[model samples]
Target: MAKYSLYINSDCSLIIEFEEEISLELSRFILGAKLAIEKASLEGFVEAVPAYNSLLLIFEPKAFQVERLLQETKELLDKTKSLAPSQSTRHDIPVCYHESLAPDLAYVANHAGIPTEELIKLHSQAEYPVYMLGFLPGFLYLGNLNKALHCPRRENPRPRVDAGSVAIGGDQTGVYPIASPGGWHIIGKTPISMLDSSRQNPAIAKPLDTIIFKPISLEEFNQYDH
Candidate 1:
């Protein structure tokens, strides 16, 4: 059994936080709870947002019932299990890790005591799961970064990181999704559009989705129809 705590975040919101390190099992468990809550259609329930280690449940302010809802949620979540991995949508995203596209490739490689090509090789080989969407309109927090590729966030966050920039910060790697100020060390760039507000599902991927990075040359990247 996992230890967790539920607390009123606001009059219209409650939070369930798991006291555990972030992991694939935790992500699956949290998302499972979110799906179960969504399925239950609890009274006044608006939505349940799941992250790496927690779930934030929102409800109609006027109909808020914190105590009852907490108990009900505890019961609901207790019965929930990790979601099946097969349900995850998989994407093989292409990335150009050339020096021009990757400003910190050499720096990161040096930090890991490996050459840039080896660093790229290690990064591209691993499969990363989208733990959550946040920080920007469609930014994905990817998990399972190769430990050798792990490095600290840049001391100076850039004022603007172009959309599609694949970066590493702490223990996770992710794509920028959209142009924005960021602190992650950029190591490559993808050409895919990760956000489209016109669509009902604005994000290109969702929690539990898996992304595989495929290294591409500058010519191939330029030829890609973005």
Candidate 2:
């Protein structure tokens, strides 16, 4: 990985870029940078947010000058190069793939020329990585779906997707934590509250978390709902 000069934004943010594309290595690099920044008790360091191919470092000016922090951040980035990848935390998310639950199951199955059962099997088999949290609160963008299952977004997006709606777009899979307009083909729904703002920890998954979807019956989902 080639390291470039650190980029400082007027918003008290610094960006250290290695690559411009998304990959396992890039994700690991983002995580490594995150860990390094968090570990440093720099007076002005506010928060570090990781994206598809870069990390955003936020700081305050009163406690730490931008110029000094920029140098310190570059040092931190250099240190991350020697660190190991994060040991991922696995989360088994339960999904109910019933016809009633998965409105787009028929369409997705037809598009792949596969039976619905096979479609469900393919979806639940892979261990997806938590790429980033964006677009919505606690809305996960997991990657590496079985390529055969890759499909385009709905031609007409629904005005309001149900909360806990599990859907797929292209080669990525995600869960809708709140009802909102969505274009991803809905294939299932989970009872898990991935984003409960009332809870101390609102987001259920974090960057580098491994997500394994477990299929459940509608009856089982109802039982958990209660």
Candidate 3:
């Protein structure tokens, strides 16, 4: 455990920094602070974002001054630190690694010095932690890949990676939320839509959520996609 120091970034934003390495514990603490502040319903508190080891608080000056908000945030952080890490809902996503869907399968395999079949097995077997969503809307950065399967990002980012593409970049794996330019080495893709703006809650996963992908055949994938 470490002591947190609060600092003012601007009139409306305050940052609480945890003097610790970026890990699951730190992320949970950030989430705890978020939950606490939300529970308090403190006026002027607009939003909160948790990164690897710090929490950023956004507020409105009309409703909260720097001193009041800092005190309120500190109290919430104290309460949050005492609580245990909260368990998040897990999502089991289905993916298909067939030829047409996974263009970078062979490339990643070659880069890792392993056969494509072995690479797929290692990737599918691991249970990954959803670290956070960034890089794009609903784009999840999952961590702790099999060491043997680890590789770097694409030398040249693709003009547009199709939506649903599940790819690996370095130690992290991610699913493209929407069709966009990306560099992750595509190994497979899920049939499920990563994000549907029409939904009441658009993002399928959030911080601290555990995500596992089950391998399916092309037929099964198409069955679900339709």
Question: CA shift at 103, candidate 3, in angstroms?
Answer: 1.1
lDDT of 1 by residue, 93-142 (tens): 99999999999898899999999989999999988889998888888888
lDDT of model number 3: 0.83
Question: Ten consecutive residues with minimal summed lDDT in candidate 1?
Answer: 1-10
List of clashing residue pairs for candidate 3: none
Q: What tens digits encode model 2's per-residue C-alpha lDDT throughout 31-114?
A: 877888899977778888877877778888566487788888878877775225447789999999999999999899999899
lDDT of each: 0.90, 0.84, 0.83
Ranking by TM-score: 1, 3, 2
Candidate number with greatest TM-score = 1
How much is 179 displaced in model 3, in angstroms? 0.7
Looking at candidate 3, what is the lDDT of residue 45? 81
lDDT of 3 by residue, 103-198 (tens): 999989998899988888888888888766777888777877888877899889999999899999888887998999998899999989899798
TM-scores, in order shown? 0.94, 0.91, 0.92
